[model samples]
Target: MSPQARRDQLIALGLAMVGERPLEQVSIDAIAEEAGVSRALLFHYFDSKQDFHVAIARAQAEAMLECTAPEESLGDPLRILTASMSAFVDFVTDNRSAYMALIRGAASADPAMREVFDHTRSVMAGRVLDHAPALEIEPTPVVEMTVHGWIAFVEQTTISWLTDPLITRDELLAVISSALPALASAVGAVLPTAP
Candidate 1:
């Protein structure tokens, strides 16, 4: 295979492994073995294990963003927000270990890992900003701030919900889906009935 193909293959393998186990527990040796390449060959593409970790984290970040993109077909602002929020919850549910690993990096001392987490958060918040005008929500600094905080709130609530799952999935999703519009309302936007 070509170099780029080889790199993509390696990252794909890393993503698969991360879904099953935390990044720290995943070994470069095991990934090399899975790829049928020697450890040194793996290092040829990545400077170190940390570099490999960052690459896999970035790929997963991209996947999360892609999967959570609001459906343009929905058109209605509340519907779009509801669909995207459902996707976000489902994505995290589908990759619990991987999300935990990202959270670990987000809270760790390493700048690279935290960047990946923060970048994901920022992009997610930007998506809300993009859809704000449709809901008649003025995109002011206060609105932006609330949207960002809402993302963090959703993330934390999801994390906790996964651990205990005290409420039904529908109830949890209802609360999450309603959170942003309610927050925007506090910031002076009149949202239609939340989904």
Candidate 2:
């Protein structure tokens, strides 16, 4: 296989293994064997096992962002927000293991891994701020802080839902959607009166 192809293959294997457990729990030998390559060859692609796991974590983070991004074609802010939240819920449900590993795994405790995770959170917050205009909310400090707080709530709620799932997915989505107006109120943003 070509060098790039081989590298990608190894990374793919790493991601798969990570999906099964936390990055720290996955064995390098298992990943190498799963990829049908020698352990040394896997090391050749990554400077160390930590690097390999970091790559996987980064990939997972990127996937989450892509999955949760709002569809630009939706013109209404509320509709766009709802669609994005639905997509986010679907992504979390579909990739439960990966979601946990990336968001709450041992790797998240590492500085490098945590950086990737933090960036994802920042991006999510940025999206909310970006949509502020459409939502008729001014992006003031209070609004920004509220957005950050809401993102944390979303993360924790998602983790709980993934772990227990007592609530239906639609119910979880509704809970998230219902929070926006309150968040706007907390930020003192006067939303247009709902019809």
Candidate 3:
């Protein structure tokens, strides 16, 4: 395989293994074996096991961002947001294991891992802010903070749903969708009113 392909293969294997279990429980040996490569080969692609885990974490974060990104073709902001929310629900439902591993596993605590998590949250918040004009709201600090909090709520709700799935996916999506207007209203309540 080409060098890039080889590297991608290792990362793919790592992600699969990590998805199966928590990062602390996943073995580097198993990852290498699954990739049909020697442990040394895996090490060659990544300086250390930590680097391998970090790479997988980064990939997972990027995948989540891609899944939630709004389509530019959608002219209506509400339609765009709805589409993004639907994509987010589908991605979490399909990648439950990987999503759990990334969000609640050891990666949650590692500085490198936290960097990716923080970046993803910031990106999501920025996307919401980008739609402020369409939402008829100013992108004030309160709105920004509300968006961040809403993202956290989404993450927790996803984790809970993945664990038990007590509600239907459509219901879960409705619950999430219903929160946007309330969050915007909450932000509005906090903003100073004109004299």
User: Of the candidates shown, which would achieve the greatest TM-score relative to the real structure?
Assistant: 1
User: Would you list the rank order by TM-score, best first?
Assistant: 1, 3, 2
Scored by lDDT, model 1 comes in at 0.89
lDDT by residue (tens digit), candidate 2, 1-195: 999998888778777776677677777799888888888988888888778878887888888899888888988878888898998888887777777877763345578878878888889989989989877777877777788889888878978988888999989999997798677875573533422
lDDT of 3 by residue, 102-171 (tens): 6763346578777767787789889988998887888877778888888888888877887788999889
What are the Cα lDDT values of the candidates?
Answer: 0.89, 0.81, 0.80
For model 1, residues 12-94, the per-residue Cα lDDT tens digits are 99999999998897899999999999999999999999989988888988998999998989989889988998998999999
lDDT of 3: 0.80
Which portions of model 3 miss their true places by more than 4 Å?
105-107, 193-195
Provide the lDDT at 153 for model 3.
88
Residue pairs in steric clash, candidate 1?
none
Candidate 3, residue 133: Cα displacement in angstroms equals 1.2
Cα error, candidate 2, residue 135 (Å) = 1.2
Which scores better on TM-score, 1 or 2? Answer: 1
- Per-model RMSD to reference: 3.8, 3.8, 2.2
**Per the 3 Å backbone cut-off, how many clashing residue pairs does candidate 2 have?**
0
For all predicted structures, in order, the TM-scores are 0.93, 0.89, 0.90
